[model samples]
Target: MATKTPKNPQKKHDGRRKNLIDNKNLKSPRTGIRKWVYRFFVAIIWFLILLVPVTIYYAHDLPDISEITQPKGGSTVMVMDRSGGLLASYGDVYGDWLEFDDIPAVLVQAVIATEDRRFFDHGGFDIRGFMRAMIKNITTGRMVEGGSTISQQLAKNLFLSADKTLKRKIQELLFSAWLEMNFSKEEILTYYFNRVYFGSGAYGIDAAARIFFGHNARELSLIEAAMLAGVLKGPALYSPLRDLERSYRRMGDVLDNMVEAGFIQKSVAEKTKAENVQIVDKQTGGDERYFSDWIVERAASLIGRVNEPVIIYTTLMPDIQDKANKALQRIMDQEALTHKASQAALVSLDMDGGVRAMVGGTDYTVSQYNRAAQAQRQPGSAFKLFIYLAAFERGLSPDDVMRDSPVILKGWQPKNYSGEYLGQVTLREAFVRSLNTVAVKLAERINRKNVIEMARRLGLTTPIVAE
Candidate 1:
């Protein structure tokens, strides 16, 4: 039996190899799983290693939370007329800072309903909302909905720019999380109301209320609150001042949202939508915006860098401004087709150099160029006044005689506007007739530099070349 059981060496080696193959097959599933697990852990560690620097880079330029009350740029510049009427506002206009408790409940509800319904429950980032918006945007093939929560919006307003970049979006998310960790929900809502920009340069709920309804935020009606909330989506697009009908339609949408969010009854929302909401008359500053704009710049120059809110009083008269606007509009409307003129500017000043009214162009909405202040043109006959004034200061009377004949200077021939010169006319007559030749001769006689000096003494800030 021992002799017969002596196996071949090759057969024994094959049997050993077969056993090794059997063991490998038995452990194949677990070994494969283990190899995958090891790769996943390595990838995870590398991701974590990369995540730290990326997060730091995004969070580096975030605004200091300590300066939450202060805006990013300069504070508002409220320009008032001499009679204490609001002419226009430049920059962000914030009202009295109201606490969370002081905010109107309906306004808060409206904002929550329209902006972020899950605002109270979210951890700064609403994954549900984000998913919904993403799905909706994907299905619709257009960005009709935004996923940013109230905290995210606040973060953007306070810290980030409006650029739609991956970095900005990531930073916004991080800042929103930071805000959520640092402040309460009520505090976030309060900051949102106070810092979020509304239309018409208004920066807070109170400012929005005053600008849109001519009242305080506490006095906001249901529909008014809904409208204000609606304006948040697109300030310039949905502004009641810019388009009341579009604004009302947006308000309806907000009211429907409020009803859907269970903030108000459907019937109540319907009634509010049906009822006419009282909004302040759209005060675009009309043509007076030119003067307001000019005065704001002037005030800024005089006051230097404005950090806090500043009230600037000016000599603009509302009534005169209206008249100027109407007159220019009428003239442009009636004669634009005939005269081939599309724009005109007017500036009326008081005797003491106070700008009472200004029409920058045919329409401020159309063209903001202030031809009265910004444009440079030949003085033409307007310069004759300075010439006569210079002569008068040199002891020449207004009634003194001057030759009104055609004259040439440097190959340039001066002619009267009427193409007929009355020879040997009195100074007053020459000025009344606007005789260019006589005015030119007077400037040459009195010295052109003296005329420039006279103009400078009279508050002419424009450069004067005596050529």
Candidate 2:
């Protein structure tokens, strides 16, 4: 009876637990807290495990910054003017780089407003814009609207090729993520504004302003900035110096963008636009295209491959080339109208192998077939330099005697230009006079291979042969 004292006194229990650990599950008073800690650690690990895919997708979804932070300019191969002055170059022709601190806020605002209205608001990938682009691409069945921001453009310039594919987009996204992690927005914007092509062979905005407008980037007026910004679409197409009307219209579009983005007031935009941003006409008179063509060919030969464009350092006199160009233009203009399909090409290089004069074509814009060194047209009697060398190297001085006569070589017949068949003449007279018979006779005796070899050793770029 004493053992059966019913201790089921419905202990008026408070529903709220006094301890965080469940009392029923406690293995021991000592082990209770340890079990709770173990479960807490398990929950934390499960949460992290679930977040891993989200993190990976986020990383892949982010913009790639690897390209933008790279050294962008000065990789260009510069072709110096014959006087050792830097005339023209290819690749990124920038001596000075623009940094965040040096860049003007106005320029930054202009680019952000004109290029991407929501540049600052978005992560590297613009979600709203991307969705919009996706809709357009889906509906229109074409990749019409590209959702690339200023940062993405920098990435493309620095690391990616200009390929508009899904792979490029995915790669761009990953690279953009790296970029965001590495650089600040201002730094990204500075690189974007400084590295993007603005035309006239200018790689960066500073170079564009200086090259075209002849003003520092900081000194660029709103209208001038608009004109230079317009060149980003197509430098040659929107070049103010090349196409003033197109430039004005393009700049007007940029002004509209600036106004819409609230970077500039509408009234101010209209006033600036009306103030005549007429780009002054600029013509590079010392056109070194012949040398450019020559250098391109030479570079291809030296590198031994032509997969990508090669940059060449050349010794070309721009002024002299200009004079030669003008002179050749006059001569060709006069000659072309008089003769049908009658072409003339002149290449004058110095003894040290520097091109001093060149006339590639009458009009390169019309016909880009560079004739100076590209064409294989018979030099007619002009190629007599080879023959003179053939005779001279054989101990025949300028005043030596030579007999002009008919000769045959391996089924080919050789004869003098003179129908009178001049029998004997001095080597100098024959050389200066370009007599063919004696020159051919000397070539036959001197061995044609040795004669051609001498011509090659003295810097004949192209192959030569004596017949």
Candidate 3:
């Protein structure tokens, strides 16, 4: 009774004890919620104030809707051999412009399924898809999934660069919204198919079809469509010409996506996979491609900046190019390793000096340097051709004998290539044997200046210093 009386004294003194709730000091839940909401609305207002001017600044540069039908002042140069067959392409590839109705339904389905399954349902951005991608990227510790819809991709490709910046991303979103507002889904898809870049320097579905399958875009098979669709992720990484196995693997994934999206039956997907799609053989040309590249380099000078589609008729002979490529590759493959040579080049010209065939290197993909034209190597014994020609022109016959011994010219002793010298050899023997000592002796007899003059006259444009 005494303990209860002492504890209850303070409690009984006031109207309420300062226990769980103090009316004077405690905050009201209603008031707190109102304050938070007010701050949130104020923050939203500030965000709008900041976003409006930036949006206007970026949106001002957006291309007109009509301009999207074609690349802005861009065109492709179609390089062809003498037979009018496609050798290679240069500049911005436009390909054959395709309409929505002309494109294959399967190809469209493939693109939609693989790129954005909710393309028809979304406005411009896919919020749920973005959230999912965010979660997946965070959990996976890498960006394996992208939330960009087909509209977003089109917007980025058309209006903005591929730079991974916040400003670029905001511009992309705004442009995507603009694109969604301006065109129908079908029109967007048509623009996408006609403008997107595929691998092996191919742009647009038509170029992809022709380059990869050697067919028109309208004729893309089920497997072919899947492969083409897969290329949208990364053109070079998934290109059939770049990596066949990786390309097929991505193609299979696209097929699976198509089946899951109800665009194609599982059985059909399976059948397509089992049937094995036929990709264009990458080994069709080795050196002719170099010649094609050479033509491509000079094409702009020949035709000017390619702002429109142009067909360049080149001086390439496919058959001769193939032979030249094989010969160079054979020498590189058979003799290069044995002789410790890293590369080789071959240039075969027609009687009239038309570049019939040219091999830049053992593998054009590995090294694009055209040794026949671009390389500046000491010709070594090959320079002897000039000296011997000078000697021959100076009344020296092929049967004229020259001492095959080592000789010193101002402390520079020329040695034979074989490191051994014959006592006396004919001029023809020295020329055939590539005898360096004999070559130097012949150069001395021909008075070196004449040899350099003869080389200059024979189209040797490089500076020659007489030392």
RMSD (CA, Å), each prediction: 18.1, 20.3, 17.7
lDDT of 1 by residue, 212-275 (tens): 8899898888989989999999875687765577789999999999889998999999899898
Computed on alpha carbons, the lDDT of every model, listed in order, comes to 0.83, 0.67, 0.81
lDDT of 3 by residue, 378-451 (tens): 87776888998999999999999998997999999978767998979899988899898888888888798999
RMSD of 1: 18.1
Native-referenced Cα lDDT, model 1: 0.83
Clashes per candidate, residues 3 or more apart or on different chains = 0, 9, 0
**Steric clash pairs (candidate 2):** 62-177, 63-175, 63-176, 63-177, 64-175, 64-176, 64-177, 65-175, 65-179
Model 2, clash count? 9
Off by over 4 Å in 2: 1-91, 133-145, 278-282, 285-467
Query: Which sections of candidate 1 miss by over 4 Å?
Result: 1-27, 30-46, 69-91, 287-467
Model 2 C-alpha lDDT versus the unseen true structure: 0.67
TM-score, every prediction: 0.56, 0.47, 0.54
